[model samples]
Target chain A: AQSVSQHNHHVILSEAASLELGCNYSYGGTVNLFWYVQYPGQHLQLLLKYFSGDPLVKGIKGFEAEFIKSKFSFNLRKPSVQWSDTAEYFCALSGGGNKLTFGTGTQLKVEL
Target chain B: EAGVAQSPRYKIIEKRQSVAFWCNPISGHATLYWYQQILGQGPKLLIQFQNNGVVDDSQLPKDRFSAERLKGVDSTLKIQPAKLEDSAVYLCASSLVAGGHNEQFFGPGTRLTVL
Candidate 1:
């Protein structure tokens, strides 16, 4: 069965530290990738998405992801993290049929 | 425009009991979806509907779960004789259409605790 994977279960970093969350999917054909985030008490929202064009996609709140087709990965990255960036991040993929397969989320804690 | 809306932000029920969740999608959205998110895990799609018609329900546990979208607008998800493993947040999301590129707008999920 097709699946999405997030290897980093929990990550802790100091404020201003760089952030990288790994995401990989197991689909072979064409894919649409997305990164979603959930703050403390907020609903899950899309941070970024990649469909066809550029492999590097920039999203809201200074977030970006690189979709590497050869590696089947769409890893999310941020240059400088803030305490407010603490949240759970999820990676999702749509191979086709409008169905999304999501990865087990990674919880990031940014300490001041 | 308002986002997807769901009722009963939190619910607590005993195992073997029945519960239901209601979702009102953004006006004019043609696609609605239900997902179950367990602790420490990503949301899993349970069902999808397109304008009052079932588009996909492959992951929904048919024996215990049932969902409906009536009049191509509001939707409801129900679980009968819920099990302890059913404890999770039920999320409702909507999009303009059932397409791979459309962005899905999610609601504040209903946290269901089956004690």
Candidate 2:
């Protein structure tokens, strides 16, 4: 079965620290990748998405993700983080269907 | 550009009880989805609807769960004789279409706790 894997369960970082959340999918076909963020008590919001074109895609809130087809990886990255960036991030994949398979989310805590 | 809307932010029920969730998708959206998000896990798709028609429901527990999208605008999901394992957040999301690149706008989910 196709699945998504998010390597980190919990991550703690100081403000202005660089962040990278690893995501890998187990599908070989054409896939659509997405990163969603959920702040405390807030609904999940789309951060970035990758479809066809360039491997690197930028999204709202200064978030970006790179889709590498060879490794089946779409890793999220941010050069600097803020305290308000504390949230739970989810990696999802959609291939050949409208359904999305999501990974166990990564909880990030940013310290001041 | 209003986002999706869901009612009853939270609910607590005992096992064997029945509960229903309501969702109103964004205007002009043709595709709506319901997902189950267990604590500490990512959201899992339960059903998908397109213009009041069922598109995909392979993951839905049809034995105990039922859903409907009347007029293709508002939808309801019901679980009869809910089990303890049914406790999870039910999320409603809508997209303009079922395409791969269409962004899905989500609503604040209804959290259900089955004791």
Q: Using Cα atoms with residue i matched to residue i, what is each candidate's TM-score against the true structure? A: 0.98, 0.98
Show pairs that collide, candidate 1.
none
DockQ of 1: 0.84
In model 1, which regions exceed 4 Å deviation? none
Docking class of 2: high
lDDT tens string, model 2, B24-45? 9999999999999999999999
Native contacts conserved, per model? 0.75, 0.75
CAPRI-wise, candidate 1 is high
> What is the DockQ of the complex in model 2?
0.83
- In candidate 1, chain A reaches a TM of 0.98
lDDT of each: 0.95, 0.94
